[model samples]
Target: MAPLSKDPATLATQGKKAMDESKYDEALTLYTAAIDIRPNSPLFYLQRSICHQRLQKGQEAVDDAEIALYLAEKLGKRDLKAQAQLRRGIGYFFLHRLGDALQCLKWSKKLDEKEKSLNLWFPKVEVGLSKLEEGDERANATVPELPDVSDKIAAEKPSTPAPVSNASPAASTAVKQATGVTTPVDKIREEMIQNNTHVTWTLYVKGVPKDKASVIMEPRSFHISFPLANGSEYSIDKDPLFAEIDVDNSRSSVLSTKIELHMKKKVEGKKWLAMEAKEEDVKAEQASAPVNKPAAAPSYPTSSRTGPKNWDTIVTDVNDDEEEGDPVNSLFKTIFKNADDDTKRAMMKSYVESQGTALSTNWEEVGKKKMEVTPPEGMEAKPYEM
Candidate 1:
């Protein structure tokens, strides 16, 4: 085995590279090691949460994302906080919790509307919520209840009824046609066990004649039926399997009283949560699905239309003054340069709003007009002297 690194930063760097290469399991291991070395690092938790999401571990991803969000808030890292919210929302989406998912995604959008991945996820969540609401409304519609029929039905029927047969002629005929067995079949009990390389089904059936029992297996499902001596049928209707199997390699054996079915797994080491996957869940998985490889981080616009219409021009003028080696302008430029993009945009917006006139992008003309109208409070008069 290769040596493990003691430094958390090194481990995290390696983890990111592994994720970029589509090696999610490897990335998860490396991120776990990094977390072990430095438990308080929100970035490590955030990265690991992404790995869990890709692996379809919805609960684990939600837990990790929550931790990352908490740590980011403690450290005052807004960018990381926004990303954590997005991850948490995605986890909820996978779990089919549409309301919770929508809340988180909307919060994340408020924090960073230009996030490209969020742009992709938001619409899907919206559609899911709409569908869920429609379903609820349909279910709530009232249905007419049946009228009382007990008295009329009792008066029409005879007091002494004839003995009922366990198997109706139609049922027996259908069973014979399907399984080539004349015996009556009832409900057969079954249990499924899935492992790394196979799926085994154990069926409890009593007193089935060897010649009468029939078992059929398919890639995604199985069927077994036989007649019991008690005049009842024991059989499994065509039932869906947890996952696809290799039908050619699957076979069944009759023990003294039970039937054992052995099926080779088509995909080794995959964990299945349900006996049958739901159609909606399958479609949701295909929509906004996690990729095997990490996508490049999206670039956000530094300014938006919601900010000052002339924000870009004002910033350029300030930059120009700083380049001319003016001490006051240089000091102002340094302050603005050190601030985050959101803060800078807010500042520009405030200045433009204070002007009380239509905004203009032509900074040279606007700057001259602004200087004449009234110099900004913090700016020195010398800088604006004509």
Candidate 2:
């Protein structure tokens, strides 16, 4: 008789426990074990997707959430299906695919309006959409500010406006002097240097005294101004940076003829072509460079029995210039490279069983009986409050 200890449901229960304790890696391993036991279980995939998201593996989270959605649909699990959609939407949000995230969130909300998680995430999806519409540079500033709904709930008397005062002759004169003040404008030449680690911008202002110059740097913007001849001011003001920078790490230096800004990137290993990058620049780069192409296999002898005979047999030949190479090991390597850790373990288990190999003595009994388990709870998983 087959032991009930290895049931997928029981393993999933243990995975949920680990997740609650913030042991995400252990939870991932347990969930993977459950998935290996029953690949068709939507719950297992959904749990693993959450683990992937917690680990900051956006692509992996997206893949698992998609698989969970498919399985939930096949099983006619409405609640699970809605949760799967929410997971996919969250995954897309993390990937910065705002359009896709909004679409998925809309569908999820339609399917389960009362779902707490859906309600919580709906605003975030809307925020992302708003960001895309307003422009990426100003997106961070576009958070939806909810009006005071409580005031509407209660009746309140309208307040009268304050009376406007006419300016006296002396006050009018002072206002005119303030408004008529003008500063001399100077020609400021700027140069930008950018790389993976940092972005440096320098502005050269001719005929400006070093003592009169001032420079201010913020996380996302900078300002530089100097007094010119005859009390006139030459200024460069409110310029946006390429990306959000470490304000603590950034510094500005004013020399006799120039002001230099050194900005350390918030995200390391990110390449910047310009001192100020827009959403269009990032999109253009992604569109030009595709990620779906399979890596080229290393060269091998055609006659080598252990090596692949034709690479085309393993993965689609993306490079038209290269001739086909070995096929045997190429297919295995391609599949292995593309598969998740759980899928690889499942394949290994099947191979070992087929070979009549003895199971490891140290392998402990995992799943005992089917156990009902709720998804891990999060503080942010509640419905939005006005």
Could you tell me how far off, in angstroms, the CA of residue 196 lies in candidate 1 after the best superposition?
A: 56
Model 1 CA deviation exceeding 4 Å by range: 133-386
lDDT of 1 by residue, 1-386 (tens): 25766555456667877988878899998888766645555677788989898778888887788777766665666676788889888887777777777778777787767455674466456545545645553223121111232343233332235457689899976654554333224455667788888877787654455544545566776655444454343435333455578877777786655788888987789776766656564444444344342232222222233432455666667556535433323433555565544445544544443332122223334333331222222122222111
Q: What is the lDDT of candidate 1?
A: 0.59
Most accurate candidate by TM-score:
1
Worst 10 residues of 1 by lDDT: 377-386
Once fitted onto the true fold, the runs of candidate 2 whose alpha carbons sit more than 4 angstroms away are 1-5, 133-386
lDDT of 2 at 39: 56
Alpha-carbon error at 65 in model 1, in Å? 0.5
lDDT against the true structure, each candidate: 0.59, 0.55
